[model samples]
Target: MLLVFFLMVAKSVHRIGPTEVGLVTKRFGRKLPDDNPIAFNREAGHQADLLMPGMRMKWWPIFTVTKFPWVQIQAGEIGVVISQVGRSLPIGAKSARYRTEFGTFTDLRGFISGGGEKGVQRPVLPPGSLVPIHPVGFLVITARHVHGLPVAPEFAALARGGKLVAQSFKLDPKQLEVAVIAPHGTTDVIGLVTTLEGEPLPSGDLASRIGAFDDIVALETDRAVTDAQVIDILMGTKNGLHNNYQDFQAFLDAGGRIGLQHDPLLYGAYLLNPFLVRVELVPMLVVNQGQVAVIKSFVGLPTLDTSGEEFKFGSIVAPGHRGIWQEPLRTGKYAINPRIYAAELVPTFILTLNWANAASQAHDLDARLEPIVGKSREGFIFTIDLQVQIHVPDARAPKVISMVGTMKNLVNEVLQSAVGNHFRNTLQALEAVKFIETREQVQQSAHTAVTRYLAGYEIETKGVYIQDVVFPDELVAVLTRREIANQERATYKEQQAAQTARIEMEKARGTADMQAELAAAQVSVDINGNRAQAREAQAGGDAAYTRITGQAEADRVQAIGLAEAKATEALGVARAAGFAAQREAIGEMPTALVAVAGAVAEGKINVVPDILVTGNGSSLDGLAATLMRKLSPAQDGQPG
Candidate 1:
């Protein structure tokens, strides 16, 4: 009896695999009142609760258990949950209702009590997790992860289908620069999105509400997801701070409107759900350093008056208002969506538009303009190449755009036609060849007219230059012949002037030569006069020296004469002294007599003076004779 009972228990046992879940069905239970396929309470049908990976008893022929593999979501993957037996969606409701209080559908009792709508649910299962779903009420489907890399060909195929370039490269602000390398990519690329599944759009609205994560995960899995739906690009306060669709949910929560947005994805990579969003790469709006991007907005608040501001409104708004913006975007990079706002790149730099057949080195904007041609008053046809430089001030860029559309439109629609008409009309009243002679006046007139015309449109004319002029072939031949004759006449006049100059030069040279000879003669006369003056000065100096020497000798002779006379008187006194004293003094007279005789000998006197005779002639004669004899004893030649 024990062995039989163990066999019956073994036969009733059933097992579910580790990677799977089992759904239990109640056997021989009371029938449900509504008789629906699923019973809210345990009835003669599948049970409300699921059996997780384990063995169960009494699950044999009487009660059936269905085994299903747990939903496995890989890294970067998301699983969308769908409830099969929850409350139905209200008739007028847009989608399955979402309420954050229900704890992400993890608690079955809470979900049921919270009246979780029977349909798609919010809050997707994140990457790297397995979810156990009850077969009776819930089903989980694995949503493929979007690959940012190009290993998978889904994006490439979708890109080709939407007529977009499959390849993309990020411009590392430090990488390749546009100023040097120019620009790349198609001119018509755009952000194309096709929402496969989402909340239904409101009445009269082109785009549906921005979906949460669960709605994004519930995108269609097959080919229907690849269809092209133009996506509204993000813009303004939400521009790129949303991190290139990486933080789109936050953008939406921050009052980001749905449908086509005004901000575009710059050149780079993005991971987006294929079913929820599709991108069409569009051309970039490059506002170069010297340009101003005039913005014509199709969305924003009401325009306000700026009648007394630096940026006066001429159908332009202040920075944040609607209508055409007065303050333009200065030089820089901007990711723009063309559908929302039109950006006219008005060059704030010198813009030169050429009216000529030849292309200019400045820019290609004037390549198609034709040379100005008109008939003069004398019915002579002439052609002129004109270059007009214009400028739209940074503050006036939007005004120009409001008046016109773009720089090209301003040139093609307004300036080109106006300038051509003015030249055609004004030149018809001027003389053809004389127009070249007084060309400055024509340029001035052209400039003045154009400036006045452009002032009405808020554009500045910097300058008007007449580049080249082409005359009719026959007119050119006639002009050349007339010019050759005129040049010959000018040459004759110049030759006459040269001859006169040469004659004047010779006259000057002759005068200079005469002055040089006169200077030399004057120098010789000056030398002779200086020599004569030197000789006269020498003679005067010699005569003066002789006169001075003669006076000095006469004065010396006078002094010697006076001294001798005094000595002679003294000798006489001694000789005539009293008898006794005379004898005594006479002895000293001999010494005096010797000194007198010596002086007489030195003087070489031939005769003695009679005045020197004393009282008796004979005695004096005798004394004189004695002195002479004494003096003669010293003579060399005379006999003593």
Candidate 2:
């Protein structure tokens, strides 16, 4: 009765709360009804009532009830078991035996024993019992201990194969404990064992498990290790190894894989391929900065070719790829023999011949090459007696190198064309002074022709000078003849000028002679007029003198006559007076005689005696003589 009462009281206690659910324990034969009053009841008086939070329940002893604590109300408690043997248990087997406070508990003995009223229980066993349980409820059974049980050897072997051996020896199994076993007992092994068993050991735990290179041991597991977890384990093991050989061995032994790195090696000697082959143009004129070098002119004639060849390393091994090689093998990876291989070949001049031909070839080459020569206009060209030096003051060496090929080809082509077409004519025209006028025109024409020929290039055409135009002997002779002709024409012009001067001088002389003759004639006329005037003056003076003398004589004679007459008259009067005085004595007779005497005296004055004296002449001879003497005396004394 007491037992019945105790059972009923035990059943009256109920579980309640948010996480709790009431569990009912009934007799084996009894069937609880679907509509039973206990299903809805919260009071402890029903067979089993769920006591909810804030709800009241009354304990009743009449019906038996038991409050089963809600196992779902607690947090999960996980347990692990490790085996030293190298094997894993079947899935869920280990979890079944794992004693978690909230999880389902396994009845190991119940599984082993046949069904009965009281199937299996934990208790102190007799000393000789085949299986034993530790006093601690949480103690796990391992394969080693299980092998020691009173089972046949075959049965033990089968048990080891089927159950004790790990499902995966290389990794830990899921939800199962792991065990690391080692032949040698060391702290590393201990740590590794602990770690594999899901007991949190220090990092690098598994790496320390491997004893030596040959050491072999079994680890137990039933599940796969996740990739992330495996990586974490490997990293931890690498850190532990850290350049130590023993640690490395331990890592390998613990199923750790190692990794490494390496470098490439170089091979046999060979030259590097040239990266850039530049063809530039050089101009005959001044080369400007950034100007493309190009061909200018060509000289002489020779079979000339301006083509260039380029070889390249193709496909990293073959040759003769041509053009600029941009890529080369890595220096460290490729060995280059500088002496053995010709990495770059620039054919500056290829043709072979005599000096003249060579020179001609060179000139032709220059025509081809000039196109690629880089030039700076800043530099000056210095020309001496026979040589010329082109000074490039501001030349860009790199640009020059780049342009060399192009310049060469241009120079060659230009020289060839120029010499072939214009050389002979230019030489002929340059032979004489007369042709000097046309020389410039010819040179300009040549330059224009050359420029037009090289128009495809980028060089400028500066002034072209004819250094020395060589003429053949025949051309020289022709030039000399022309010069002679010009000289003769000049001489003839000078002679004509001299003749004109002589003609003018002759005309001037003739005019002077005529003027002198006219002057002489006028002088003669003047002299004649002066002589005539003198003769006329002399005649007039003589005539006037004669007339005066004659008039004086006439007057004197007449006066004497008149004086005689008057004197006779006076004498007559005197005689008459005397006579009168006498006449008074003989008057009348004396008058006649006086008159006659006067007349006679007047006549005698004319060298004749007067007739009146004749009358007295008879007596007059004596008287006359006397009279003459007296008259002479008187005439001498008196003024008459």
Candidate 3:
């Protein structure tokens, strides 16, 4: 029965929390039967099963229950009674009774209340005498103290010499060193010595067995717990300064830790944040209008009409404002450094104009006045008659506002300088005719001078003309006298020229008449000569024709005469022969003879021979003679 009870109680044990475990033992070395008796089962063979918080087991009268504590434990009930052994208490035993409160058991070491102080000596036991004692009674042995009796050297040596206790100490701002405890064995056997005032354990003493008597023992400090409060302070302060208060509080709540180096109060004060104006200008030029006009002055001014004013330094002058004085106005106020700022002149002269006319008028006046003032060898005032035509190429209006002032001064200077001594002398010499030629010469000079002056400035000189001329009072008188004398001389020369022209005209007319007469005479001579030649030619032709005709007529007449002469000779010879023949034929018949003779006389005899040799020739000859005589005598009576 006893063995059964022990087994049941021994099995009715369990552990709580991580650092502790429970062990159960049996009474009288006996084991009981278990519900599940596997070899690995820790609760095998026992009616006292492993007891959890609410688990219950059958408790038999024959079995004894016992518990072996394997680690440290805390009793949870308040005001529970706890018995201390091997610990000395106060003289009043009842008043010195020990009690537990708030789940913690308080030590009664050094609890005496009387005037006579009693010291309790530490009891030294032989090895293994306090083995297997319950921790609740053994752990309270730290309450004992020693007094009165002189300590024996051997016992003192043994008490002081047993195991050495090590301690660590530190001071807070209050100069109180906090004690740290390190334990290696049973709490009842160990001792700690320290110098911290009012500390519960200046010298640590152990009330419970730790290990074997021969084994060296030591205390291990709970560093995490020992430094926890200080680490919390540092972490909290550091968080507050670093703006990490929330994180620091979380760390404390979660049992997180830090070291001394994380303190926030040790930081230094200096810290840096760092920053940059841009300038620009417009380009332009200015020109004068005189003999010195060839030189241009540079004016650094804005080309546009800008509301914002620009300042200039150095040699530049302010356009609208008074020039900066070299001296300061007051002690703290300085005249603006001449090298620092300047006022800008807005460029108003972009419009183009014809300035040539202005210069011409000035030149004419200068010429006329020079002689009148007896200053012909000096400079004179010239009028500048300008023909200004403003041309605005861009949308901007022509900037004529500044031009009026500029032109006035420019004209004055130019006229004064340009009408020099040489110009004056020339004007004086031609004083009488100065007015007449002044416009022409002035126009010429002005065009030349003004063009050169404005060349660099790029201003266009469209044209120039001499509009009018004016002479000084003195010059007018001198010029008028000179003019009268000039008019008289001009009149005399005109009359001489007229006479010379008339004489020349008459000479030319006479010459022309002489030439005409000479031509006529020559023509008459030619005509007469030609007539004579024609007459001679006609006479020669007529003579030749007459000679030829006379020769031809003479030849014709000679030929006819020769032919008639031969015919006449032949007729005479034939007639004589016929007459002879007829006389012979008509022999001795008076009538027939007469008839034949008449026929022969009329030249009609047909057969008459000159020698009539007929048969009766001789006889008939005589008869014919007689008949012819008779016939002749009869014809003589009628016609023979």
lDDT (CA) per prediction: 0.61, 0.32, 0.33
Off by over 4 Å in 2: 1-438, 499-640
Best by TM-score: 1
Residue-by-residue lDDT tens digits, candidate 1, 1-640: 8997777778667687897876666677888545233545777776666667778665455667777776666664454455654577777432355566654354555667787776555444555666665544554444332111111133235435443221222112211111111235434333533333334444444432233112223332333442111111223224355454433344444444545544455544454433233455556666778887877765543565553465443556544344676667766666665665677777788898889887768567787788988888888787878899998888777777776766777887888889988888877877777787888988899999999999988788999888888888887898899999999999999999999999999998897879878788789889988988998898789889988997898889888988998898788666445423633666544644555656667885545565555664676676678566654533453222
Give per-residue lDDT, candidate 3, residue 97: 25
What would the per-residue lDDT of candidate 3 be over residues 166-267, giving only the tens digit for each residue? 111111111111111222242211111111111121122211111111111111133443222321221233234312211222323332232111112112
Best by lDDT: 1
lDDT of 2 by residue, 600-636 (tens): 6776433333444545457557566644553342334
Give the range where candidate 1 is weakest over 10 consecutive residues by summed lDDT. Answer: 170-179
Candidate 1 local Cα displacement, residue 425, angstroms: 2.4
Question: Would you estimate the TM-scores of all the predictions?
Answer: 0.55, 0.20, 0.20
